[model samples]
Target: MTAVPEEQPAWRQRAVERSTRAAKLRAEQRVQRFLDAAQELIAEKRTTDFTVQEVVDRSKQSLRSFYQHFDGKHELLLALFEDALSKSAAEIRETAGSQSDPLQALRLAVEMLFEQSLSNPGVERPLFSDFALQLLVKHPAQVATAHLPLHQVFTELVEQAEDAGVIPAGKPRRQASILMQTVMFVAQGNGVPAGSHAAAVSAEEVWQFCLGGLSGVPVRN
Candidate 1:
């Protein structure tokens, strides 16, 4: 018969648990450092062409730590992208939630999105140019997952609008999706040439077009 192992004391067990928790916290800090370094490089270079080694160097973390946390560069980028969009979704939701009118809430959300895309070209440019497009093409499912938070916010606004009779009684979620796509298309024009007509489009114009579509009215110039 195999010998029975001795049980750990309660105090010892509690100490072990505390050690594990501390280790997990440190690991999370290391992961965040890697992410922050990668974001800094992307902003500085205005592209996502940098390497994992570069991120490691910038983060002051080891290669082993990065690999331990992430599979590789693509995985890191995906994490960073998800984190960013999630934060943006939260901010937009908060802002929209403050508005009394559903239509105004929706408009404010769209305007904020457009403004972010334009104002923070350093981060937004690389995100939209490389990571987002690549994910859309190769990992459409991941794209949908990453975009879910923002989509949900829009859907909620659309539902509110429909309930308030500001929009027609139809598929609110589908309408929200269409509106999101429309806004993103126009916002992505931030990557266009500075003097081009596409680049000339403003957030107000985008909002006006979306409002017109939502209300079934022709947009006036």
Candidate 2:
């Protein structure tokens, strides 16, 4: 009947929609796999030394799927760098918020952030590598956007500490940014760097030693 044809078209459209959703879901999963594989390789090697074929194999996804998700390894590395920076910055804010005092919170925030460098970035890697750094630097606005959350936390804490007479009055955000950058580079990847010197130096030890220079006066624990 004519009525049956109209109903059949609606049914077909629904089926097509369902099929499209399933395909999209599969593509996203494949993308995640590729990202994980790339992260593993980059962390261990400190460079994009691995090949696209290797990442595709590790992801258990086909080369076509890999290309669909990323144009190439450079794009994948950029995603990872942006992701890691934003993720770590958010964590620092959360951790720093839990401290009793602004100074203490700042220290905790710094120590926790310092863990990010623990990925063992030797001279070869040196944080995002020159190639990746150059790419990220080109997108300064994006980089700053990713860092804004952590910067805001620092700015707020600096204001609080200054108002409470905990720290000297100065450019709170600028000072905070400098401090955060210093601590972030202290460790290698995302935790405290491991070594004889690092082993002997506890996070608290580092904090106490630098307190005088940081506070310009003795700070109580």
Candidate 3:
């Protein structure tokens, strides 16, 4: 019988590549744990007062591992903002998928996003609130980079709707940006004056108005 040949070089290279990928995934998971822990802490206290050490303890991860993923607490907050935006976008996409009409899907996405902000108390105030947004304004690079994923999702949905003839041809990205900015204020309750008799418009109403403008459909009262 012929002797079996030793493992091929390409095979060894592939094995090393797989090992590297596994290590990368594990590192990401650890980083995500820290963000999740931070969110939980904010929820518990309804504020961003917790220390990095407390986040590390909540994550059950070593300080060394935390440093490996993020430079400092501020960087970690940037990561948290990015992660929350991405998660919110994903959920909106999932809910919007149930609709057959592309225009309705776009509206559904907006409704779902607003509902998510309302469902999580800390979410609205921590990341998307006007007060929080002002703090991030100085870090334009970080904010722009972190917000790109959510922007992409919103822009894509609008483009698809227009392409499907669900809405008239217009500047999809511009529309998406305007819609996103407007919804944040609406969700943060900024539009309603405190102790006023004015009725704040619902997310559905906002969506209908947007649809009316884009598709020339009449807005329902």
Candidate 4:
């Protein structure tokens, strides 16, 4: 046999490495596909009877592949919660940071949250599928963890406003907790009951309500 060139072996090695990398990438994609499919189903229908097999079928991935990525349905649900929190937190940071005025930033942040709740009604549906409801019913720790980022951002903004003499300095944590609670109450469809349908509040309404409660006036225009 003719001697194989060194470059040929090196090229084969690179090809093998690439194939391994592609496998890993595909694995990651499958994991995300499952998560996306689960969220879509949960968003469209009820999560009361959702199952891992359902997710696998929706994602077009094998059940074995699903287990390779997640421990079980509970684990997958927790992952979904964490993913939602991460996405919401990132959006909050970006929207809030873009506003120079602290109060306006806070309002915008709240509005963005309201919009998200509306868009993902199944996830945030006041009586249907409260984000906090599931956590309170199944996993309190997850709910507590989810509040951390919201609390942090709210506390920071409150403290900053205090420093600027925009709002009276007091207990930031207490204030943030109250704000979160109020938002949840509104999101949970507790504001009022409409005929056959529940009252759906808009982001502007939430922003105004929060502003009023905090004694914060919307920045001019």
The CA lDDT of each predicted structure is: 0.83, 0.68, 0.75, 0.72
The parts of candidate 2 lying over 4 Å away from their true place are 1-27, 43-47, 119-139, 186-221
Candidate 3 TM-score, true structure as reference: 0.78
lDDT of 2 by residue, 82-130 (tens): 6766776677778878787888887777666655544443322224643
How should the candidates be ordered by lDDT, best one leading? Answer: 1, 3, 4, 2
Q: Which ranges in model 4 have alpha carbons more than 4 Å from their true place? A: 1-27, 43-48, 119-132, 190-200, 216-221
TM-score of each: 0.86, 0.65, 0.78, 0.71
The model with the greater lDDT, 1 or 2, is 1
Pairs clashing within candidate 3 = none
Off by over 4 Å in 3: 1-8, 122-131, 164-166, 190-200, 215-221
Q: Write the per-residue lDDT of candidate 3 for residues 61-140, one digit (tens) a residue.
A: 88898888888877877776777777777777777777778877888887766665543446533253522565467677
User: Tens digits of per-residue lDDT for model 4 on 44-132?
Assistant: 77553587888999999899999898888877777776667667767787878887888777777777666565434456332224334
The candidate with the higher TM-score, 1 or 4, is 1
lDDT assessment of candidate 3:
0.75
* Model 4 residue 218 CA deviation in Å: 16
The root-mean-square deviation over C-alpha atoms between each candidate and the true structure, in angstroms, is 3.4, 7.2, 5.4, 7.4
Flag the better candidate by lDDT, 1 or 4: 1
In model 1, residue pairs whose N, Cα or C atoms come closer than 3 Å (at least 3 residues apart or on different chains), thus clashing, are none
Error of 1 at 180 (Å): 1.3
Best by lDDT: 1
